[model samples]
Target: MEYIGSRVINASRATIANILADIRRLPEWNPAILSVTAIDPRVLVGKPYSIRAKLPGSPTIIYEQVSTDYVVWHLDGLQAHETGAWKLVSLADQKTEVTHTITHSGAIFRMLAGAFRTVPGLRLDRLQRRAEFGQERAGREN
Candidate 1:
């Protein structure tokens, strides 16, 4: 199963990409992420990082690809395997269009597919708010 979401953010592509690349700061913007503990603090492709989320499992996620405009990561959980990709397109006036895609596999994911459908959209909404306003302001608004 796949879930996709897109949002136009008021920040530049570099700004948005930088935020995405910094896995350690995920919890600051993504509410579903509780914390991230990386083996290496720097984001090197192929290195695995463990993320504790609001959900049931603490998945080991790896950065498969990272570039100026896109990023791809794979998450291995006890019950599911997921691949997440982010594509960024620069727009006029320092804006960026970000598309987040998640492909899920495994029996558990297949059975709970409907419940996960909204995950991507919710993450994108939080990311947009974080990019447009500072974390402090976004938190207040939320």
Candidate 2:
């Protein structure tokens, strides 16, 4: 099964991508994320990190597919599963469109994943708020 979502943000792709691509800010934006541990902010791709999340119960999910376009997340339920990238497409007028997708198989896995179908939507809301408020460029006032 595959799940996908998109959001139009009122910020430059550079700002949004820099924020999303920067792993250090994950927990600050996503409520479901409890903590992101042991990651090097300087390293942006092709590395694994453990993220503990608050989805009824705290579970540490692994980020295995860290790439420029197709990131993936692995979750263990009755079995293991996956979720994917933060794809950012630039638009005119200082806006950008963001999408997140996931692919997994198994009845229970899909069912549980369905519950999080709104995650990308919620994450987008948080991203827009942060970007609109200039939180992405924090402490860099020139």
Estimate TM-scores for all models: 0.85, 0.71
- Across 85-126, the per-residue lDDT of candidate 2 in tens digits comes to 677777765687778776666555655766766767787788
Best by lDDT: 1
Candidate 1 residue lDDT tens string, 16-121:
7777787878787766568889645457899888888644666788899888589898888778888889999988766888999999997778878788788888
> What lDDT would candidate 1 get against the real structure?
0.80
Which residue runs of candidate 1 sit more than 4 Å off their true CA positions?
39-42, 54-58, 135-142
Where does model 2 exceed 4 Å of error? 55-80, 105-108, 111-113, 137-142
